[model samples]
Target: MFLNTILNSIIQIIFFAALPFIWWLLSARKRIPFTQWIGLKPWKDRSTHLGVWIAGISAAFTAVGLALLFAFQGTETAVSVFSGRGIQAVPAVAVYAVLNTSFPEELLFRGFLLKRLQAQFGFVAANITQSLLFGLLHGALFLGTAGVGKTVLLVLFTAAIAWFMGYINEQKADGSILPSWIIHAVSNLVSGLCAAYGVL
Candidate 1:
């Protein structure tokens, strides 16, 4: 199950990477650096500013809180590949949560789709669209295990978080994904840890 968990994460990361790579090949090809184009640049000056701190910290807390809520439930709603695997899965699950799950997601949604949509429709519309899509994707993934009520909650929570992530990246982080990535990575790590302990 642990090995399968890692494999599933890898598959998701690959799927996320492939979407932007295909777009890169179709448009800029090798002209624009793919990493930078996708907001993989290192920390910006504003990345450490007060506003960034507030946004990042609060969002991380919210995610962690939601995760804890589900963990307390100790039901199917607390979906994770590491679920029921116990502490033995912690080390690998921790790595996967940060690297495979959160990293690629930020790259794809906040980095690729948000920017693409922003260019075409401005920030407000773009953020909403990408957030909705992000929420829908998660909703679909959790529908079977989380059930209708929890899945609806997941969709709303995910969309709100995604929008906030995009907002911070664009407004506070100078379009860098670093802030959102860090928040996402931390959130995933905590959630994965809970799951590894069979709390979620």
Candidate 2:
């Protein structure tokens, strides 16, 4: 099982890594520099992006805080990492979750999709649309394991948080996905560790 999981995660990581370039080639037509278009450039403005310091740091903490709250009192949900798979899986899970799931998700959602949507429409509609898509993806991933009620709550909660993340990427991060990516990467790390330790 562990081997299978690792191989599968590796495959996912590769695909996720390719997705941005794929988008650049197919949809974006590669007009803008791929890195800049994906908002992978250096911190544009500290006063805006992470200049406040609190913006980036707090996002990570908030994700951890929310996860803890969910584990302790809110609707319980089972993620793939929540298996009783022993400590041996912790490192692999953390690395894969952060690289495959967290990184790609922010790139695709906030960097690519949200930016494109915002260009066509406005921030509100774009944010909501991307947030819903983000939430729905999580709901689908968890539905089989987490059941309907928990999935519903999870979707709503995920979408709400995602909207805030979108806001941060645009308003606070100066169109860079760095802030939300840090937030998500930290969240995934903590969650993966907790689940491996059977805390979640």
RMSD of each: 2.9, 3.8
State the lDDT of candidate 1 residue by residue for 1-200, as single tens digits: 55766777788888889989889889987688888888888655643474557456656655644664563374443245567777788777776767776888898999999999999999999999999999999788767866788778878888888888888788777788877888887777677677678664
lDDT of 2 by residue, 1-200 (tens): 45655676677756765867787888666477887888886666745436555355556555744564464343453244444676788767766656656777887889888998999999999999999999999788767766788778778877887887898788766788887777776666666666666665
Alpha-carbon TM-score of each model against the true structure: 0.82, 0.77
Tell me how candidate 2 scores on lDDT: 0.72
The lDDT for every candidate, in the order shown, is 0.76, 0.72
Error of 2 at 167 (Å): 0.9
Instruction: State how far residue 127 of model 1 sits from its true place (Å).
Output: 0.7
The lDDT of model 1 is 0.76
Q: In model 1, where do residues sit more than 4 Å from their true spots? A: 1-6, 50-79, 84-86
> Alpha carbon lDDT of residue 113, candidate 2?
86
